[model samples]
Target: MRTRILLAVAAAATLTIAGCGKTPITPADSSAAIAGLGSEHVKVGMAYDIGGRGDKSFNDMAAAGLDRAKEELEIEATEATPEGGDDEGRLGALNKLIDSGHNPVIAVGFQYVNALTKVASEHPETTFAIIDDDSIKADNVVSLVFAEEQGSYLVGAAAALKSRSGVVGYIGGVEIPLLQKFEAGFAAGAKRVNPDVKVRTQYLSAPPDFSGFGDPDKAKKIATGMLADGADVIYAAAGGSGAGALQAVAAEKGATFIGVDSDQYQSADAQLQPVILTSMLKRVDNAVFQEIQAFIKGDRAGGTRRFDLKTDGVGYSTSNQALIKPLTPKLEQLRQQLYDGRIVAPTKP
Candidate 1:
């Protein structure tokens, strides 16, 4: 879908009226005001990550953001999914969006960082926004990164509290700094709850392969091993690999699992639903929408934009009301402490 709207970036100048006062207008403020202006029909484009759409995770959350933008901003938007799992394929799709005249293109995942950086630099007139990755340094590009550790910490505490075996586990897609943030926070949260709790960590691959994220069978195997080792709650930071953990939890007796990115309560089958404790909510949708809105309003802030728990950009899911009701108040307290600077979460692994 495409919508066309006229948008102009006003130049800075001094306006003088006869027998009146003179007013000075700065270029930055004028550009911001112009970007803020939205018409009945605006065109936007979105590029999905490797997982594509309907993974019920990161890509899905990003799609939701695009959908919301369509409804609220009356934007005519279309999304392009990569044909194959290569950076070239991803860049090709993004190029198609730009060549087709889609302004303000938004890349859904960190995997698009290099592609976006290259494209944004090539097309300085086009605006771009990226989530989860920050490889791009162009002024026309906006990078949205999150503090996954803060949300993971709270969920880790919940996992430790609910674990009967006193052994918790974390499974990650890769060992990169981003995934490491999730692992470290979860481990810290679990340890904070129970000093004696054993937190086991595992990654699908050591060097990090994008394909490993969607391997459910691999996730199931890792999760089953953790369960066999007396792990009661396993937190999955693996993208598609998380599905395997859910499957293992469903098959295993008396084992629980925590999901990442989005709430997996409804994503799982009826039997597995009960076993899903909660998800570490990374509010990617909010971040995406806010950035797009800013771009439309000419208020684009070019640089790395951090989304933390304090900003309500990242958090633990409360969608599973029955499972999370008892823990909400305490979690809120911790969230407040983090926002008030009373609590500090470690960023490094």
Candidate 2:
């Protein structure tokens, strides 16, 4: 029932992935080595965001990372989602994971900041990593964040280049500063390409109401309105609600949808694939994998790690090659500018 929350704005300083010199835990000896972690093999806990694993977007990417660790690194894993989808639920989920002997628990959303802050203090020995948030300043916690604006900027330019109506739309799951980064970067990129480009923006929900991430029906209504208003290209950063935008865009001829967090076109339905012009790939899976990899190597430093274009942490998908091919050259040029520090994407709207 706690409504208090700390909003995480993107950090300005970019840090590379940290490395550890501790002896690596081989698959055969990992079980006996990680004594306090779990009963058997090295066990990791995954606490998913609102829509959980099957969301086919953010949460799914986190799951994919965990799955990769399990297969490649030979680690045991247990995953859980918030039953009530609130701060209390987040705390409960974390507690459940730790109680089950899973160490190095990864909370797959910024919404877990408060819950993680409390649980982390209680379990000082248990290492924790939070995705999309860097507000926690604890030794046992690491913030796995991404340069969302950079990726969003590229897609926004793509949206503008692909738009015939001169107006593009942005849909945010919630009206938080974090989500604002996506809107800001998208608008800025669009304007950079076409100074007179029109950007339509809206949020499905506000603070204390995170239901927006899961409410596709409302997103559908909003996207429908944007399309009717002459938006030919729409970029949705609204978690699972983005599925609705994809469906809406699919039904409208000559309209395109930009996906976020994952390569949504691959996970999207076969019929909805064509409408997906491109997706802003926030490599949450790679972040999760790196966190687990560092942990297994006995690197317990809970410092913040930033994933940006320099590290290939975020990017645009190339699934719809035919549609995106023509725009590739320009997009790649813009991407290089971002990577070379020639262009800096806005982190705020």
Candidate 3:
């Protein structure tokens, strides 16, 4: 089920947003996948987004995939975290891995688009995968992007259904098309469920100022303000900043917090766990594992590989015991509607 479609980094083709974008990258034939991963150990490298591994969100899921590739396919993988989110910082981290003789380097965030585009062309001998971004048109780079808005719609519906207060809040790490899609689907879903529901949205920072993803203090303050304004249910799409929002939720007694990317219900902070009503489970792990798997199979063509509801790339996490259980039937109906073209989650603010 491997087909190829050229993806533009700056523009998108007519791929359905609910279907993981343009290409239908079903798992490559199993025989080829196994043969591609012969008995030899494959060396894989990764550069994480800001906040790195302990962020317990996007980067952690990327780590899980790399770890699984090592354990199951006998690959030797090393990861590097950037000191800053700027192009220079990301370039240094990527160059460090390349210097260590790592091939098929993986850049975990769209913030690395500039660095990856420049470096990938300079080193055609190496292969690279960029998660959450597909603007690069290099033949050596694979765009491991997902239909985030589709899954976000599901959780947004959940938030609307569970909110005792008619108002809900959304917190985003950075203001970009990537995070903006989350905001769009969330607000859309809430409005779809109940037209009058007020959805307050805020972004901690904009592009080039990528500190928002890991800034707990600012996220906490933002969440505190949103909750104080009658937002009983809040969703945080700000990576580690979400942890701070959860902290605020924990202190607010009756408030509920929704997580994004990873399952916040499994947080190390036990107090944060119970406060998490649900998480928009974006399967960063699946996209990472599959792209790396394809690379192993000698499939290094640069193009768009879409992961969506059909590919199990995104959904609502079951971290808490049935937080969305009562709404499962309705959720499933809405999910099918998304797939069948009845519902279209917006990708813009």
Judging by TM-score, tell me the better candidate of 1 and 2.
Answer: 2
**Candidate 1: minimum summed lDDT over ten consecutive residues — where?**
15-24
* lDDT of predicted model 3: 0.79
Off by over 4 Å in 3: 1-36
Write down the lDDT of every candidate, Cα atoms only.
0.76, 0.83, 0.79
Instruction: Give the Cα-based TM-score of candidate 3 against the true structure.
Output: 0.89
Q: What's the lDDT for candidate 1? A: 0.76
The candidate, 2 or 3, that scores higher on lDDT is 2
Candidate 3: C-alpha RMSD after superposition: 5.7
The C-alpha stretches of model 2 lying farther than 4 A from their native spots are 1-40
Residue 140, candidate 3: how far off, in angstroms?
A: 0.5
Task: Arrange candidates, best lDDT first.
Answer: 2, 3, 1
Reference-based lDDT, residue 26, model 2: 33
Tens digit per residue, CA lDDT, model 3, 1-349: 2345423120111122322112223343434335435554568999998778877899998997787566545578889998876889999999999888898899998889999998998899999999988889878888888788988898888888888889999999999889999999999988888889999999999967888887999999999999899998899999888878888888896788888887767765775677777888787776777777767767788888887676667777655765667766777788889877788889997
